[model samples]
Structure formats: C-alpha cells, structure tokens
Target: MASGTVLRSHAGGYLVYEPELDTVFQCAARGRLKKERVSIFTGDRVELDELDSEQNTAVITTMLERENLLSRPPLANVDQVIIVQAVHQPEWNPLLTDRYIVHFQLELSPALPVLCFNKCDLAEESELEALRSIYEPLGYFVIFVSAVTGRGIDDLARTLANKVSVFAGQSGVGKSTLLNCIEKDLQLKTGVMDHEFGVGRHTTTSSELYRLSFEHFPEIRASQTASWVGDTPGFNLLELKHPQPTEVVWQFPEILRLAQDCKFLNCLHLVENDCNVLNNIDEISLGRYNSYAAIVSDAQMEYSRRQVTSQKVEATVKKVGGRGGKEIHVPRLSTKYRAVSRRRERQGQYEEIDTDDDSIDDSLDATEDDTFQDGIVGQENLD
Candidate 1:
C-alpha cells in the first residue's frame, strides 16, 4: 500500500499526492470508509491500495490521523491562515477583519493568522502602517503586497514555505488575483479535472488543496516542503457562531487587557458606569474600539437570534388513536421572544384586544339602560 495526502476531496473520490513517488493520483475511498462514519477532507493523509502507476490512480484504503482542522471550509492539518484584505476600493474594514480573527479563535485553530494587506499600490503607506500598529503588537505577521506591481510578492511567497496555509478574507480583496500573480502555473489549470480522468471540477463544495512547487516558481520558494494552499470559497464572509456574552471581550487581546481596570468583573464595556474601556477610550484606536463594540453586539445578537430559532424549532409529536388509525398531533411551540430579541419590545396583542372589548361592552350596557329607561311606552301605538 502507498501512503499519500489528499489534495482535493470531491467527485465521490480524491486526488491523493504521494510524495514518495512525487506524484498526484485520483483515488476513491473504500465503501466501508463511509459505513464507519468517517469523513474525508482535503489535506488528509491516507493509505492507498490497488495502485496503478501507469494511469496514476489508486483507491484509499485507510485515513491517517490529522493534526488540526480549519473552520468554514473545514480542511484538516492547517498550519496558517493568510488573512488577505484590500487597502482601498472596498476600504479596509477593521470590523470584518477582526471578525475573521475571532472566527479563527472560536474554531480553536492552532495555526497563527498572517495579516496581509493587498493593493498597497493603491493606498498610502501610512494606511498600511496604521493596520500594522494594531495587530503587530499582538504578535501577528503583517505583510503589504500589490498584486499589480508584485510588491512584497516574493516575501509573502517565502513565508508560505513548509506550511499548509489557507487564504481567507473578504471577497474582491484580490485573493484570486494575488494567488495567480504568485503562482503563474494556476493559469494553465483554471477549472478542475478533465472528463477522461473522471476528475472533473470537484462536485463537492468542500475546499480543495493546490500543491505549490518550487520548481514551478524558483524565484519565490526554493525548497519543496509539502506546501499547499486551499482557496476557501464563500469563507470570505465568515459568520461567527454564537459565543457567550461575557466571552466576547476575551477574544480581543487589547480590550481584554484594559478590561481588568473595569469596576465590575463582568463589565461589557458598552456604556457601563466607570467602564475602563470607555474611560480610557483615547488610549486605543477609535476605529478598532468601534469595531470591537459592533463585533460584541453582533455576536450577542446572533446568539440570541439562534436561541429563539432553536426554541421555536423544537417540536414534540404525539400519536393518538385506538387500533383503527393513528392521529399525529404536533403541538405549537411557544413563540414568546426575549426582550433582547428585538430592538424594542411592544405590548402584547391580547391586552389591546381586551381593552377594546371592555369599551364595546360599556357602550352596549348604556344603550340597554336607555332603551328600557323610557317610561312612556310607544309600543302600543306601533302595535
């Protein structure tokens, strides 16, 4: 059996790359692999049998242990995340950038995120430095590159060596363009596999790993380190899962530090009296602070929204009948929403309906009293 790493997972099979033979082959997992409830992801190492070196194909018999897993695309054994963001055009969004960071932490990714600013040629150097100042202090690797002019391309390329890095950030931030610039060979292969090989474009939506070679681009990386990159489509706008209300600040290293001086241990830093974050707001970048506030609010709000949805979705089915037939009874779930569920909670409709009913009853009572109160009877004339 030959051992290989899965470079792409789709089409009910995989493109496994065996370094021993220095070749990539199309392989499918054993039928029992699915029965065992094992999921195969890109970047997974597996044991292959029934190898056909001539056709460059094989069957994956077993999957090896993984070092880690990435969120969103959910690739395994990720070494780093290249957080690419544009310097202009769309403008640098600090909130979205920070949100990605929090997403990484929430996923418990062991890899460090590399902050890369693309389109440096369009924006000013001061703009680039401003971003660096915030994250550099937190021990993040920051880079500025222009896909047009190839600025900082070689530097960014060198750092990717020996690491299974994934490019993640907002769309239209020049991720594809930048990658194309760094790896010229990508142009030769735009779409997925061809029909003859039964390896057409990956039918699955899972992320696919592309192997990087020093031989292809000698100017960038000299050594082959099993380096691969996964272009995580739709992962650009990473939606964070619900986090605890108090756990939001802990995600921000800068804010969490000053939060120690807050009057309350659980201070959320949003308009709280004597709040250290608000009191010393000038000490931090106002933009970042605003971003932080919005992130926390969004996380909390998202959490609340999910909770309401879950509560409403929980349903109990009841079957009632004798021996003839059975009736499936599904009870309605409570739709009561929390005060925080909405921006402003309004009064219930029951109270308004009751008030209107009471008013109508009072009018009827007066009408009845007046109709009977007339002592002079005109009913005899009518008869």
Candidate 2:
C-alpha cells in the first residue's frame, strides 16, 4: 500500500496526493472502511491500495491516526486556524470575533489561533492600531492585509509557511479573495457583498486543502517548505457547547489569569466579593468582557437544562435486561399498573378471613330470633 494525504473529498471520491511519487490519484474508500463508518477528511494521512497506474486510480484502505480533528469545517491535523475577518464592509464585530476565538480554543486546543483582518486598505490607520492593541496582548498573531492592494500579504504568507492552516470566518469576508492574491493559480471564486443585507454572500460551500506555492515570493522560495491551507465554508452563527460557568473563564486568558488571584478558588468574577477579575476589570477590554458575559450566560442555561434532563431520566427510567441479556433503560411502570407479587396476594387473602367469620355469626343470630316469633303466633291462633 502507498501512503498519501487526502486533499479533498467529494461525491465522486477522494483526491489523494502521494508525496513520495509527487503524484495525485483519484481514489475511493475500501468497502470495509465504508462499512466501519470511518470518515475521511481533508488533511488526513491515508494508505492507498489497489493502484491502477494507467488510470491513476486507487482505493483508500486505511486512515492513519490524526494529531487533531476539527468538527466545524471537518479538517484534520491542523497546525493553525487563521480567523479571517473584514475591517469594514461587513464591519468588524468584536462579539462574533471573540466567539470564533473561543470556538477554536475549545475545538482544537493544540492548534494556534491567528487573527487576519482583511480589507485594510479601506480601514484607517487608527482602526488597524486599535485591532492590534486589542488582540496582540492576548498572545494572538494579528495580520492586517488587503487582498485588493496586496498589502501585508507577505506577512500573511510567512505565517502560513510549513504549516497546515485553515481560513475561516463569516461569509463574504474575502477569505477566497485573499487566498487568490497569495496564490493566483487558485483563482478561487469570490463573492460580492450584499449591499441590501450588509453581509458577504457565501461562495465556498465545502472545505478543501490546497498546496501553496511561493514561486512569486522570492523570500519564501528559498525555504522550500511545503505549506497546505484549507479554505472552509463561511458561517455567521456559532453555538458553543455547554461548559460549566466557571470553566468559561479558561477560554478568556485575561480573565483566567486574574481569577487565579481571587479570594475564592471558583470565582466567576461577576458580583463576588474579593474577585480579582472584577477588581481589575479596567485591564480587560469592555468588548471582551461583554462577550465573556454572554457566553457564560449561555453556558449557565445549558448546564441547567442538562441537569433537569438528567434528573428526569433518573426518575422515570429504569435498567432492565434485554433479549440478549444486555441491560437497557426502559420507562418505569406506574404504581396502578405494576404487577402484585404472589406472596403479597396470599397475605391479603389471610387478612380477609376474620371479617368473613363475623358476618356468618351475625346471620345465624337473626335466624334464631325469627323462628321464636313464628312459634308464638301459631299457638295463639289455635286457642
């Protein structure tokens, strides 16, 4: 079997690139893999069997272990996730941006998160400085680039060198356009901004990894390191998984650091006394704090919902043996519908005997009295 990396997955099959031969093959997964329900995503290292050299086709037999996998765009073994946001047109939204940062932090903890703000040409110098001031201190690598003017493209390209990166952001933020500027050969489809709705139209519908070439950029050409990038479909709404309210602080590094100095070990930084985070709130940006508050609120609600659901499950469901002796949870039967045990039925029968004996005795006494009265009446009639 030959080893290769999956570059794309489509309805037809996968496109696997064999680095040893520097050859690309159109391949389908083995039937056994399909039956096992193993999913193949872009950036997955796989083993190919049943090669047809003439047809340039093969069958993917095995998927190697991944370093990390992201479920949102469904990419594997990512080194960094570069969140591409716009500086103007769609308008830079801090809340949405923070959500993206927190999402990557939770989904792919090992991978680094970089912020790349596109359309810098349209933004003022103050705007660019303001962005850097907000994110740079947070240990995030920030890049201001304009695909139209090609400003700061080199810096962006350097960051991508020798890494498997993913470009993700809201629709119509120029993710595709920026990539095309870096590598003109791609010519990825670019969408126009919807002036009516003030959003960018969705152009990328799926995720696909592309090998980057720096032949035009003389500085990076000497390094000769291979760089792969995946362009994923853009999205606007991001729903975070339910985490504990206290755990939400971990996503915000600034708050987490201050929380360590709080009087309470599990300080939420809200209205708690001696809360270091709240005491030093001025150090944290207002926008970041607002985002943190919103996320914590959502997490609290989700946690409550889960708690109620668990209680209901415990109350109404019971474990029972199934056909093959496997245990399963079934709904508990109501009291009126439950079967009575044989021992209990016998006990009830014994309890009713005393009441039956008393009724028989009373009937016998009444019969004796009636007989005496009848005899007296007959004797009087004869006289």
Candidate 3:
C-alpha cells in the first residue's frame, strides 16, 4: 500500500503525487466510489494499492477525509485564491472584481482571496495605486506585477509556498502569463487579449496542478518551497450560488464591520435611514456601493425565483406511495379546462331533476271535474 494526493484528474484516471518518494502514480479509483456517488477530485489525499514502484503506477482504493472542497471546479483543500486582473486590457472592471470576491466567499470557507493586479506596466500608476489603497486597508494583499517585465513574481511565488493556491480571474487577465513568469520551467501557453473586444481567449482549457521550483532563489530551499499551484481556465464570469439578500453585507468586510452600528438588524444599507455604513463613512466608493446594491438585488431576485420554483415542485400532481412509489406529474391548470369541468357538473345535475310539472296540472283539472259531478248529483236528489 502507498499514499498520495491526487495532482490532477485525467481521462478515467488520476495523477497522484507521493510526497514520501517525490513520485507520481497514474491510478484509477475503486469501482465502489462510483456506485456510492462519491466523486474523486484533484487535491484529494487517497490510499493506493497495487503499487509498482518501477512503473510509478497504482490503483486508488480509498479517498481520505478532505480539509475542504470547492465544487465549482471540484478542487479540494485550497488554501488561498489568487485573483488576477489586468490593469488595462479588460479595463479593470471593479464590478467584475467585486463579483469574483463574492464568488470565493460563497464557495471557499474562511475565504482567503488575494487580489493580484497583473500587467501593471500597461496601466497608469494612479490606477494601480487606487486598488492598493482600497484593498490593502481592507486587509487584502494586493500584488502588482508585470508578467512582461517579471516584476513581483518572486513575492507572488513566495506567498503560494507551503499552501495550496489556485489562480482565478477574468479571461485575458494574464493568469497563465503570471504563472509562466513565476516558474520558467512551466512555460504555460498564454493567449493574447483581443484588441477589438479587449478580452483574452481561453489559453488554458483545464485546471492542472504544477509544482513550484525555488531553485532560482538560493536563499529559499527547493525542499521547503516544494508546493503545488493550480492554474484554471479563465472565464468571463463565474456562475455563483447566490447568498441570501440580508447575507450580502457579510461579503464586504469593510461594510460588514460598519453595519454592526446600523439601527436595523437587517439593514441592506440601500434605503436605511440609520445605516452605519453610510454614517461611518461619507460613502463607500461608488464602484463598491453599486456592486453591493447589484449583488443584493440579484440575490433577492434569485431567492424569489427559488421560492416560486420550490412551491411548484411541492405542489405534487400525484403521489404513488406505499406500493412501489410511483408518481404522476401534476398537469398545470388553465381557465378553459376549468370552465369545461364546471359545465359538465351542471349538465349532470339538470338530468337528475324530475319532470313532474305536466302531472301536477292534470291532477288539478281532475279534482275540479269530480267536484262539479258531485254538486249536480246532490241537486237531483234534493228535487
């Protein structure tokens, strides 16, 4: 038996790296894991059997307990996220940046996100300084680097050391370029951002873990710096599992701290007369405030939609239970069919009524005739 962490999941198999021997084993997971619907993902520590040291291969038999897991790309035990942003190419969309923050906040526990501004050489000094001023005060480490000039690559690499780090950012933000610059041996393929659209093509199609080398830095030991970094494919925007509307405040640390002073416990800060967020500061940055508002509204809309959908799902058409649980889909009702049902009920009632009006009239006429005959017979006897 051997132990290894899955470095990457490939076609029907995984690339497992064993730290004990600094070796990699290409292995397939046990069949039972699939039957149980347990997913095998990258960064999972697994127990391997059928080991062949000579061939560096094995079969994974057990998946160990995970520290955490991010279901979006299914990476486990991620220590931190490096959110890359190009300074100028995509025009530094602050709303997009805010959205990315909200993304990891919901997905990653303890939510460690370091905002990295890449391609700084292409942007103005004022632009970079603004981000540093805002985010640094908010307890976020903001790294300004120029992949083209190899600036701040060392600092970025050192930060990722002794931690499992993953890069996330918008397309064309130079995510791959930054990694390529950090480790020359990686030589990751980087795509050029489109001049017309200002968006970068997807250069890295999949997420894969790459080992970081500190051999270049004599002060840093390669053995100590031995760590893993995963570069995922860039996206225009990540689909998010929205937080509750009231929960959106917690996503913004600066605002959340001030929100405690609000008069209302559930202050969204938009229409609150006594919002501490507004009282504490004249106003949050327009960009930040707008993003906050947008997020809250989006969340509220999603919550409403979910409630409606849940109501529909709960309104069962028919339940076949206690006899081999079968269900029939309830069909939706419309006015036309409802009217037809009512009409059929009325027609049935009409048919059930007795038609006795003609009999009653004939009985009345017969009684009158009998009275007349009796009167004539009595008169004859008197005479």
Among the numbered candidates, top TM-score falls to 2
Order of candidates by TM-score, top first?
2, 3, 1
For each candidate in turn, the TM-score is 0.72, 0.78, 0.77
- Candidate 3 stretches with Cα past 4 Å from truth are 222-225, 236-238, 279-283, 311-383
Which candidate model has the greater TM-score, 2 or 3?
A: 2
Q: Which ten residues in a row have the lowest lDDT in candidate 3?
A: 358-367
**How well is each residue in 1-383 modelled by candidate 2, as lDDT tens digits?**
69998888644478888877788898777655554445677889999887777898878878897777776677888989999999988889898788788777766663458999999988999999999999999899999999989899999999988999999888878899988888889999989998876677566767789988876788887895789999977643423343467777877878878876888865678888768899999999999999999878877776778788873211323568877888764434323235778997787566644333211111112221132233233221111
Ranking by lDDT: 2, 3, 1
299 in model 2: Cα distance from truth in Å? 1.7
| Cα RMSD (angstroms) for every candidate in the order listed | 24.2, 27.4, 28.9
Pick the lDDT winner. 2
Candidate 2 contains a number of clashing pairs equal to 0
lDDT (Cα, tens digit) per residue for candidate 1, span 220-336: 555665688876543424244434566667666688778867888667898888788888888877767887788778767766776888742122122356477765332221122
Model 1 segments more than 4 A misplaced = 108-110, 188-206, 216-224, 236-238, 309-383
The alpha-carbon deviation from the true structure for residue 157 of candidate 1, after best TM-score superposition, in angstroms, is: 1.0
What C-alpha lDDT values do all the predictions have?
Answer: 0.65, 0.76, 0.70
